[model samples]
Target: MDLGCNRSGKPKLTATIRRADSIKKGCPFMLKGRFDRVGNFWKLQVVNETHNHEPFVFKEGHAYLRRMFDEEVDMVARLHMGGLKTQRIVSLLCKWFPGACVIDKDIYNLIEKLKKEIIVGDTPMQVHVFEFDLL
Candidate 1:
């Protein structure tokens, strides 16, 4: 998973690491929390504090594991075209998919790829020229 940033610009920390079957490292630490009405604040209770496997101390990935669904790409294009910044796009994506994390570089890369598809490549240029000729 890619590193995530919070409102204070600090890297968000998590114990849960999703890994493939070949490199599975399991950590059995869980924190279940709820709001306490009496204190009017949140309270956290640790369900299990045993470490079966190593937890990730530093997050490192090129977002290769994140599979961008077709609808997500479409949303990226639409939001980018609507003048939303990449950070906002990432935030929106996280909000839209609660269990998912999005990295801005991926959005940037996707935008560049989409631009290439629509801009002056041989096929794209030929189609644009053909349309112009028709006009």
Candidate 2:
């Protein structure tokens, strides 16, 4: 509902609100949201995951998402361990697993789900924003 703008031309994002529509009611996937503050100091909560189960790690004839000769999970773990930025992670992935198409969004989504934390870093810089240290 017109979430307004954040000084810049970019529209400020808000929590996903489903309008009263038959399509939303008929949809099987459940919606969830989380709030995160970016380096630009703007806060927004977006709908992250819908389905209860994980998407297919592999499809009928080929790798579905990452399609890497090496598994993505391992690479993700390595990136986390190395504390690399999204671009660095992608570069490392390219070096190790060439021909793999690893999107930063996908990497963020995977990191969010598996690590239960937000990938907080700037575009040209890197930093460990936060970690969900649950005791």
Candidate 3:
């Protein structure tokens, strides 16, 4: 789960539960909660508690379960390719997608995946010779 401030300056928390290998293809379990400032406490809520398929063991390195959309990923890759730092990219994303729950690590992972997909080279010297292309 990641915690961040929403557009209205209120704290928001979100979490996503990926489907198991046995489950059918569909949207992952998702939950979004917000803090009630007047109530002076956190208000947790389940956005999608019921799974469309069966449950199984959780897998590792499921970056696709992230809340970011495909277009957002492309934008992040573009920004990173354009020389923006991870921190700066995060700030920009936060501003651009207020309801989105993104973290520095997510952007870092996206950049890594983008690099892996775009810039491929057999030798070390050949690295960085490929042009930027959004996947």
Candidate 4:
């Protein structure tokens, strides 16, 4: 979760970055125990009577929530280099990275990351190539 803020709270943006996360911090998860009668669910207990932090409001920006594992990233690179479209890649990623909240935007971000690793700095050249290919 390089949220544009370094540990010292400074920006180190190398490229144009757009962030849409509204994640917060200092939230604790707690709940009260309610009886479940469907399947004799007596194995649950509540240790705290009150939840101190807001879960819903601060649960968005955790890096683990949307992070791609090393293996997952490798698969993404393989799938992309094999000429698979982004949409298809995303669909397959869901199957491969089950329980992961991966979206098309994440796929595109990963693709761009892979591109950055290969091509040093040719963003403008990419745009020019796109235009040339369209002709």
Candidate 4 accuracy as TM-score: 0.49
lDDT of 4 by residue, 8-84 (tens): 22234445467543433322333445556898664445443344344444322555577888888999888877778
Candidate 3 C-alpha lDDT tens digits along 57-135: 4422334444689778888978977888889998898788775667788888877787676556446545534532331
Error of 2 at 65 (Å): 4.8
Worst 10 residues of 3 by lDDT: 4-13
TM-score of each: 0.46, 0.37, 0.45, 0.49
After best superposition, candidate 4 residue 31: deviation in angstroms? 14
Which residue pairs show collisions in model 1? none
Residue 82, model 3: lDDT of 83
In model 1, the runs with Cα more than 4 Å from the true position are: 1-62, 122-135
Better of 1 and 2 by TM-score: 1
- Which candidate achieves the best TM-score against the true structure? 4
Better of 1 and 2 by lDDT: 1
Which model scores highest in lDDT? 1
**Full-model lDDT for every candidate:** 0.66, 0.51, 0.62, 0.62
- The sequence of per-residue lDDT tens digits that candidate 2 reaches over residues 18-111 is 6332211222342333344464444444333243334444432222535444476677767766777888887777687766777676677776
Each candidate: RMSD to true structure? 12.8, 18.4, 14.7, 11.2
Q: Write the per-residue lDDT of candidate 1 for residues 19-59, one digit (tens) a residue.
A: 33223234445667788889899777777666554544434
- Model 2 stretches astray by more than 4 angstroms: 1-70, 117-135
Going through the candidates in order, what is the number of backbone clashes in each? Answer: 0, 0, 0, 0
Candidate 2 lDDT (Cα, 0 to 1): 0.51
**Clashing pairs in model 4?**
none
